[model samples]
Target: MSTDAVLVRVRALWEGLAAVPVSFSSATGVSVVVSPRALICPPGWMGVVALQGEAIVTAPSSGAAVAIRAAVARLSADGLVDPDLLGRALPLAEVLGPAALAYVDGDGFRPVSAGSLAVERLAVEDSELRQLLMVAGDQDAAESGLDEITSPAFVIRDGGKVIAAAGYRVWPSRTAHLCVLTAPDRRGQGLARVAGSAAVAHALEGGLLAQWRARASESRRVALALGFRELGAQLSVRLS
Candidate 1:
């Protein structure tokens, strides 16, 4: 299959999940209101379900329409939904497909300085940044709806222009996942690492554990460098 075709399928799946209305919390000090209307799931084995708000989902609800809602409610009441909320409730065995959690070891990773780049937290005021991220890659093009929700983000700027960005859709559990992008012109400068570190420190300050869904090789390298270990893998079913 062509690369574009693969990306299209991936985007569709992620958008579908993100569209689900489910509240979530993370150990990275990120909280969001993941209304079904504003969900943006990430594609591939990341199993990223972009939600808004600070709620947890435990068990699938009785009705299909409200199953995720029920899950979050159940998890929240049990108090198992705090700090690494998703990790505690959604085990890889249950949430991911076979081989979804597979990854290679990433050694020789190194941390970067968080302050080397000019970073700014994005808010509703930073619509341009959102727009830029919305089209950062073909995958993002498939999930364009991500622009509708305003999550906390950090941008690396060069001479008043954004060169890279990293953001988290916080959940109640004090953990947040890292979503980063570096502009084509700024790849080698370690802008992603810098912005990512800033995001991690932000999460740590909030008593959250920062997590990210990365490609096997990329994840191994970045996570190891940032002190993150393999949690599990999330698999995707290609539509054809």
Candidate 2:
């Protein structure tokens, strides 16, 4: 995509997310706060909790505006979404995606030397080769899916197999939506931290925010280990 095209797409995305208002009351009398601007969700997914930093928004799947307001009122006068209470509000709520706590910090990001990990940049030109290395039995298969990307990807090799991977989905070019996958057998070996550092370093180097929206419980360890900070979790779901 051209620079102008990227700028246009990013601007439209930001505007869409900003249009949604923050609310807490759902028609179900649940208290929650939501970003009215948050537009990311799956089809038929009525309920959602949009989160960014301290900013939050909640909308019941039922599309009840009153529920959103009431939920917020139940939470507090300020009406901020508290992730801990989200489950109690909608415990059975089918998660539309990997419901995760969002963590991000730039205090320790630096250019990573490949080291003994043999980290390499996986570019779009090698999509065919990348697919061959994307093994489902690799352990982190559940989380390793390259749906799309704007930045060059990163990976670490062990023996001859790809043990870990890192990359970002660029939106607005300001925040890099980070992605990572490590073979379950190779996780504790610090391959993820090492490969992730390279990806993050490149993100910061390009003047982008290294956004770490981690989902897996163990993912926090990798993010924090790589010098990222906990920002909070963003929750969303597709109402059954």
Candidate 3:
């Protein structure tokens, strides 16, 4: 579970999600492939994943792939995944992401400082955890992806109410895609770090590569605190 090993697994995951054969390389600058079956994207959506000094553009059509490949030449390998820049440079009607994509192995994980806060392992479908997500509202709930986790949740409660939770969905290649949530009123209190740390520890014990995709700075900070290294970014675009 060295840094290099994690990156290799991540690259394979992305390539499989691309739905078409594609070779990503730092030497190639950017590689585009046409795949209507792009599993990482919604139907008709296109995606770009940049990692380890390489980039891959997955488009539903060759025409769109050609256009994106052309525009990305003017963009840096890292910038290829920036939604704002991609939206402007391409014929994008809507965009998602520019989110940080990170991963960690057992060696890199930093356990949480639980202190007085109690962390518990609960079912991913726990009723209390669902209530916590409802209180967090729609946008935050969706961002957390807590409802989609396949692993048990690591939760923190306050005054008998669940305030924060973290877990992961098993993705292809035995990757654990992390999902973490903190109550709106309970953020900035390190609850996320503690819950997320527990989840990471569980994933590592299960021999899964822990992955964290963070859009908010606070979320990114929590991931970093848990020793996840931000390797790249991901963007999904709907063509006009």
Best by TM-score: 3
Itemize residue pairs with steric clashes in candidate 3.
none
- TM-score of the candidate numbered 2? 0.69
lDDT of 3 by residue, 1-240 (tens): 688888888889998989888867746677888999887677788888889678888888888878877888788777777766666678778888878899999999999888998899889778999999999999999989999999999999988999999999999998999999999998998899999999999999999999999889999999999999998888888989
lDDT agreement with native, every candidate: 0.45, 0.54, 0.88
Two-way lDDT contest, 2 vs 3, winner: 3
For residues 1-240, what per-residue lDDT tens digits would candidate 2 score against the true structure?
Answer: 333343343333433543454332235333333433345453434333333322334454345445555445556322233444544443334664334433333545544556656878878447532553465354444355443557777877766666677877775547777777776566677776777787788777776766666667677777777766554344455433
Clashes per prediction?
A: 40, 30, 0
Cα shift from native, residue 222, model 3 (Å) = 0.3
Ranking by lDDT: 3, 2, 1
TM-scores of the candidates in the order shown: 0.49, 0.69, 0.95
Better of 2 and 3 by TM-score: 3
> Stretches of candidate 3 above 4 Å error?
none
